[model samples]
Target: MITKILQYYRGFVRARIVSHSPERFLNLCRNHQIILQDLVYRDGYYECQMDLKDFQRIRPIAHKSHTRLFILKKCGFPFFLYRNRHRKVTYISCALFVIVLYVMSLFIWDIQFEGNQKYTDDVLMTFLHSQGYVQGMKVHNVVCEDLEKAIRNEYEDINWVSARIDGTRLVVKIKENTGILEIEEKNYEEGDLIADKDGVVVSVITRKGTPMVHKGDTVSVGDVLVAGTLEILDDSGGVMAQHRVQADADIILERTYEYNDYIPATYIERNYIKERKHYFIQFFDYRFQIFPVEKKENTEIITTKNQCHLFSNFYIPVYYGSCQERIYEETEKSYTETEAKQLCERNLQYYFKNLKKLGVEIIQNNVTIKWDVNGCTANGTIVVHEKAGKLSQEQQVEETMKANEYH
Candidate 1:
């Protein structure tokens, strides 16, 4: 492939040799170190392609072989230039286009992110913009090591980051910490674990602090499940001092979640009439239309764009593709009883799926859906077993101690 490209750049020719001694001619050409491509014989004549320089050296060989050479076809850059030499303006425009492309290549045209889970592309791009790194910035200004460090410092969950420049694109790859995050012991402030929802305690395991509730105990929102202060005792069993620490515990509880959802019977449905397609070419911000676009009401335009690139990762700002306009009409429609019930069930299932994603174990689903002429309604309670505590300030421990002293 590379040889062919070089041949085209240097120009080449196909010549027919009317020689009685074709074998001798070929041997003489080879002995003279001449390269011939696409050699063939047909109807008592020989034809082959050779570079212009080699063709120039072939005249003496042809004369010795008693052969006549005829230039059948000329191809490649030199011939193209000679044929279009009169079109000076076209040549100038082409040179200008190449120069523009080269200039654009010095600046970043696209910014891409990979291996991101918790943070989205927009979030990362926004951060980069705030740090004065953005698309169209000079590629030479990008310090990949600094960018990686900045990203790692900015996002706590990002465990590893790699930033690199690929052609005209800034590519950032990050690996997020998927394991459970642990708080540093030095940063653990005095706090107590309190119930964030109403539930019956299934189990309690304390890692630090005094347990205020036990298994099978009923708890309400804001009630302390574990106290952050421990009562230290003297030899005589009197309280010597109260040592304050952060409360750490896992409390599983059986809770009921109230679920309610409804959907209207009447809805708007779209009926597509026809689809019209138009092609467009875009250079940076300017767009040129290849086909005339018609203006119509109640139409949805879906466009697919493909950016121009020299190869992988060498993207440019030029884009071209097709836009499809789907013309549609809206009509008022009513769902049947069965359809309404099915939709309500689907919504209920989605709610359950979300709850399961949060590590909730559904014990029982008592929810039911009913459909009437007006709409569908789902109402009931979902029984689930889930972790049920959040950190709260340690003021509750002091209050509990005062209450104990009063008693």
Candidate 2:
């Protein structure tokens, strides 16, 4: 295989030799160190293939053997170049295409987002555009670490972010701040733990200070559940001294709240059609789609962006892509009783999930779901038991006075 390829590159010739003694000619050529391949004798002629350079050296041997050599074919890169040497435009166009493709690959062609929930692609891209990270810009101009840092700093809800380049595509990943609760800070100054809302006290655990309320006690908003001041009693049961400290406690309260939800049976929904228009824009390290005209009301538009490639996954930063805006028209959609019920259940699940994130424990939930030809409604009473106490901020002057008194 390797020999055949080398022979083709160096140019090879297939020739027919008219010789009375074909076997003697072949032996003489071999003895002269001439490389002859595919040698065959047929119809009173010797046929064989040899390198173009060796073909020239064989003329003397053919003459000595009294054989007439005629080239049946000449093929290879060298022959092709010689055949098309006069076509200047073809060669120039081929060279320019390769040079252009190589130059385009040095910049970004596409931007993609992953693991994002609160921030949309448009929002993230807009922010990146402001940072001079746009599409069609050289990859060397953009720093992945700096881009991640900028995104995290601008969006407080993003807990972590990453930026990376794959081929000509710029990939951005983000982890939003969700579900996790903030840690409570420690306060050394005197303060009281008061009821955050009016509810029945289900349970209480005092970690510091004194508990002013007990289980089954009904409290109102702003009422102190735990007192921050401690009184020292004398032998005669008289107050000897009083000291103020920060109160810390967990006070779980049982509360009932009304939950109501309504979903219309006949709703307007968008029906997308195949009609599409494309618009492309490039920023430094980011590229996106833009609408040339104003979008239609009550229509749903879907846009898809892809990295442009020169050939066979060989992507280039010069994006030549289109945004297909699938035009959609509003249509009336009717929901059956079963569908309405399913929708209501989904909403209830979402609501409960959010409540659980706030550390609320559901003690009882009695809900009623009803559906009609017009719509569906879900009404219920949710009884949750949760911590009802929060620390009240102590005034600056009072804190100073307390500190002085303690000293």
Candidate 3:
């Protein structure tokens, strides 16, 4: 019949028994008319705790009656006291050491790197450190824009670079540049319409010069569509110095159509062999690109990977890895007349799209191809007249940079 109210104190009940005689201690209290009371342990000894008022009345007969000690809790459970001072001290020390070790790891010491193709992770780490983001350098030392610029400048051979910090890992990625473009555009003044492709001249509008063709006229691709200037001369009709100009033209093309019939169709998967990326290791402002060495040929690739700069702060992760994917489609040649025709149509459509940007209109097109039991060959000509205007904004912006700038 115990209630939970008394449980909070871990209270237990015991009947007090004090007897020198073992038999007396074993004797039942009620049978012997002995008093029953509470008991407690003190200093390795049991003390009978009777009410003071009751104690006085029972004190006289206490020696005659054997005192009994019996627990009153519903379940008489053995108790445990706190001990083992040495064990507790050892546990606390071990826990403290582990926490200290973990906190220390938060401070990176040495950074390592891997999965690099063009540049070594160590080189990037050293460069980053020199750029104020090295071992012992607080994370805030490298700004995103600054890091991006630094990587670009340091690794000229890499066409692109990216840098970031993931947890303690700093990833710097580099891509090799694979494009080789003509450095300059040829300059021209005024010239006559020539036959680049036999085509009829349609319409022509001169933007900054004079027109050389009107609608319903036949011309070629290289045929001059516009004149760069007006003819100026002295009183004697002598020629003057010609000024450089962007001769505009819109020469409608002349074309032919021929066809060959055949059977059987084939499909093939093609891979592009051209790709570009730039990777570098920069120390302070100076940088080096290990990949994209001179005398390399046909650099197209499918994927480019890079990692963040490694540093001496944490040897575990110098930088995370990154990659870019590029896919190329091969030009398929089909023996089927219908499929070949579709392919040629698509090609012409794409060509028209490009010509539209040049102020040219493709009013009509005639296509024909030759086919045999072996295969089919398409022989066709595009009739387009285009005019030249101002250079594209992007091109002008690029032209403004006199030289490649680096940090």
Highest lDDT model number: 1
Q: Rank by lDDT, highest first.
A: 1, 2, 3
Supply the global lDDT for candidate 1.
0.88
Poorly placed runs, candidate 2 (over 4 Å): 1-7, 21-33, 63-65, 114-120, 152-162, 173-307, 316-345, 353-361, 366-407
Top TM-score model: 1
Residues forming the 10-long window of minimal summed lDDT in candidate 2: 398-407
Each model's Cα RMSD: 8.0, 8.9, 20.1
Q: Which ten residues in a row have the lowest lDDT in candidate 1?
A: 398-407
> What lDDT is reached at residue 132 by model 1?
85
lDDT of 2 by residue, 138-212 (tens): 988879999998998899878788888886778888988777556456765888899889899988898888899
Per-residue accuracy of model 3 over 1-407 as CA lDDT, tens digit each: 36443332343333344456534442433454544444455554455533223334454454465543443332122121123344777768878978855554454334444445757776777887787776544455546678779877887776666676654545666666443322244443333333455545444545555666666676655555565555445555654434434554444443442332333456665777544554554443344555533433433333333333334332332232222223455766655666766665566566667566545555456556555565555555555444322221111111121232335
Model 2: pairs clashing at backbone N, Cα or C within 3 Å: 133-285, 134-283, 134-284, 134-285, 134-286, 135-283, 135-286
| Best-to-worst ranking by TM-score | 1, 2, 3
**C-alpha lDDT values of all predictions:** 0.88, 0.81, 0.49
